[model samples]
Target: MEAPIKAPTPGAGGCGTVWWQSGTVYQIYPRSFQDSDGDGVGDLRGITARLDYLAWLGVDAVWISPFYRSPMADFGYDVADYCAVDPLFGTLADFDALISEAHRRKLKVILDFVPNHSSIAHPWFTESRASRMSAKRDWYIWRDPGPDGGPPNNWLSNFGGPAWTRDEATGQYYYHAFLPEQPDLNWRNPEVRAAMHDALRFWLARGVDGFRVDVIWHLIKDEGFRDNPQNPDFQPHQAGINRFHQVYSCDRPEVLDIIAGMRAVLRAYGERVLIGEIYLPIERLVTYYGPGLTGADLPFNFQLIQTPWRAEAVAALVAEYEAALPEGGWPNWVLGNHDQPRIAARVGEAQARIAAMLLLTLRGTPTLYYGDEIGLGHVPVPPERAQDPWGRNEPGHGRDPERTPMQWEDAPNAGFTAGTPWLPLTGDANRRNVDELRDDSRSILTLYRRLLSLRRDHSALSVGAWRGLALPSDLAAEVFAYERIADGETLRILLNFSNQGWSVPLDEGGPWQILLSTHSGRAGDRVERQLRLEPDEGVILGPPGR
Candidate 1:
């Protein structure tokens, strides 16, 4: 609960102040975090009101989802105005106040920058679509219709439908890799690149610590507008239209130049960090941190968010990511977020605590989604009640299941809104609210607090080197075991992912101390000692020779 002890250096790489090294980041879905005006939606003021809660949780930074002026087409991701806050969230002064308060609590703020596209309502797009040679027309990607009066090429949006839309006024089809209303920005243009860089400077000048670049890899498209090849294993959701491999559509080699330009702007401000959202293979993902170019400080690692719940699989992934990290590049982990289902829902309620342990103890920076520490699960929304644009298009298969509002209290609207919430509150809101579980020592929040405290107190758990241990096949499938070594201190972390009991051989030749355990049990020194782990149990053991 005490304030975090300030490290000696504020921006040095390593355990001290590497943008993301060993830091705990709390993600705030602004519209669902809290409502300041009883308007049934959260805003910047709501986040300011909850700073103490974040401080108590020991998080070092807060990654707030987009709050720019928008049409609410895709929540805040579809930016209508980049320079000011949406009236719904509050005034620009409110954002400044939020930033000041966050820093006062020693928490850094990272804004979500959606550079891939902007809402069609954006002024730049409006004028660009008004007429040919309008000076801003080239700001966005506009192409001629295909030979058969269809789309320009065989490109598909991640959300659904054609990636291009025809404009009756100009007889051109504009590109939109996501929603039809959200058109992709043409990064190939020098003027466009300069404008986006100015946008970055605008926030850095406002004292924003950094940005979480959304869809960083999708910034550049194939200049020739080539058709993507058909995917061999396309499913129903991605097939029928043009389920193709997007070799030329995204992740172009030219993205590095744009990243360098962005980095150059950040370098002007001492100690700025840029975390990119790039989903690719481990080898390709690390390349975002270019060999000689100024790459991102941390590429948001979504492996934990996408991996299955098997112990061996997770262990292998952890090792692979650590190995794949580029030199001078710090690794990061995200277990849950506004766009994905909560880890508690993905695994199970019983395993939530263990997942938290694994997350905090892992050898990298950890980002915890809002309300995740309380073991919040996704609330199933009926098709008619869904608000996600993707869900609106497909009706049932989109992410509406995970984007529900946060549960703050057991009162009406789960203390998220006094009026009707934009989304429905979950059925478990009454019991899962913060006030109900904060006092319970065994609650998931309390477990998170303890885990964070342990991480902060011990160097081995935070900035240590991880070494995977091999166990029996059956035990390996259900139990994850790894050792962390730093500053001559070694800590062994063992977690049981399943509900069944599992055992691992412990080194009995030397004294082994039980530093922490989710289950109320103890371990003593013994040669070849057997550890009987209960379901969802976790134990952190001190160094073998300590």
Candidate 2:
């Protein structure tokens, strides 16, 4: 077994830096994380019951997906009552208890805030659609039909087909970016903005540390309601939304101002963070930082998820992203999320270890998708058990494969639920699970624990300035290397993206120990002038002459 890591002194990075700046955030999909009370679904109490596990795993924060009152059309993404908890996830009291339990464990709670749209069942939408002359009618986007009596323009829903749905009673059509049941909110409406802002305050009042704002870029659309231009290189196999470049539909100029407004609200309350879920390019993504560093505290960076898994490709992506950050901007990394495939599934089991090493050691706050640490692979979702609206509409677009239940042990349902799990467990759970791997010295769980423990112990890995290390041109093809420097302490991270042993000269030539390694057996080994990396291995090395 790996040696236990002692607690590191708090505030080691510095006093002015916020906890999130140097800490790790773990995303918990409540419905898939654990099912407390065994009602066949996960609830707030289920998450509360697992706080000890998260705290033990060394996570600094827990970002739970939406738990608000919803009609479940788009799962919890379509909110009906911003201030109330859904019956499936328990009551408001249950949510409070979760906050209490999480805080007691010193783990910050980050909630998923869906500000872009609301369920058609929402009272506000109900009233707004009651009549064209209704006072709340303008609260949502409702436009008249086109000349041919079809959708206003060529815009399409993320789920598929037209973005507009006609309401026969009013001869007008409402817009929804995703599901028709989820109508787009008129963020252009001042009252809507205020109400949504107040929703943040509602949780802030109840002790939420921050929010992972869902689809923040989709909050504001083009003012003219113009058609999104078609992609010149569109493909038949890609998402339908991709047929258009989203020129007029998303990432509009006004989004920056709206994001800054959210930041202002967070700043009013001390130390709270706002993380926007943006899938734009690096150049445009940085703009979410706002004009004067006043936008999202951490506009979620997901380039790693889309970039090819190769040394040169990843290094280039990292450099491009770092260089693109606006002044005073902070960076964050995400390896996986509810909407994407798991790391292990994407890069194979062996490379997943290297991916973990890179994630925890990289110069940014890292968000760990639930079940990633234990090396959970994607669980196949049979047609009968499929749950994602996107996949149901588009055969290959479903995210159900990645939204499986957490494997806590070798029990039936992987100990996630007593009755039946909302999603099937990856059959490998019996051999690869927290209970089975926590005691195994070379298990992925142990590697993650060690990496997190090392990150906690070293300020360099947490808040240090990252600089890429130069390798001979011919020798740099399959290896990625960088240095993290803090308070004169320098650490080098070397990763071999290929499944072939590679060696790099340790030019500094002094006493150096492998602080941590992707291959567990290789960790803590002493090294010198020549460093050889096992196939698909990654290692963090203390500076020479130390």
Best-performing candidate as measured by lDDT:
2
Q: Write the per-residue lDDT of candidate 2 for residues 1-546, one digit (tens) a residue.
A: 111111212343687778989889999998888888887788888898889999989999999999899999888999999999999999999999989989999999999999999999999999999999999999999999999989899899989989999999999999999999999999989999999899889999999999999999998898889999889899999999889888777888888888888888988899998999999899988888888888898999999999999888898888888878776688889999999999999999999998999999888889999999998887888899999999989989999888888889898888889988888888677887789998998889988898899888888899887887767765577898887767768788899989899888787734678888887676567898889988998989985433
List, residue by residue over 1-546, the lDDT tens digit for candidate 1: 111112222233343556457678889889888998988889999999999999988888999999999998999899998888999999899999999999999899999998889999999999999998889999999998899988999888877788899999999999998888899999988988888888898999999998999999999999898888878887875433347887888989888888888888888998878888987878888899876637777777888877888898898888787777765566678898877888888888888888898999877788899988888887878777778888667654567666677887889888888787877877889998888888887788878887888887777677766677777788888899887766667677889988888777875323567766776435443223766777789888885543
The per-candidate count of clashes, in order, stands at 3, 0
Query: In candidate 2, how many Å is residue 39 off?
Result: 2.2
Poorest 10 consecutive residues by lDDT, candidate 1: 1-10
Q: What TM-score, over all chains together, does every model reach? A: 0.94, 0.97
- Indicate the TM-score of model 1: 0.94
- Candidate closest to the true structure, highest TM-score: 2
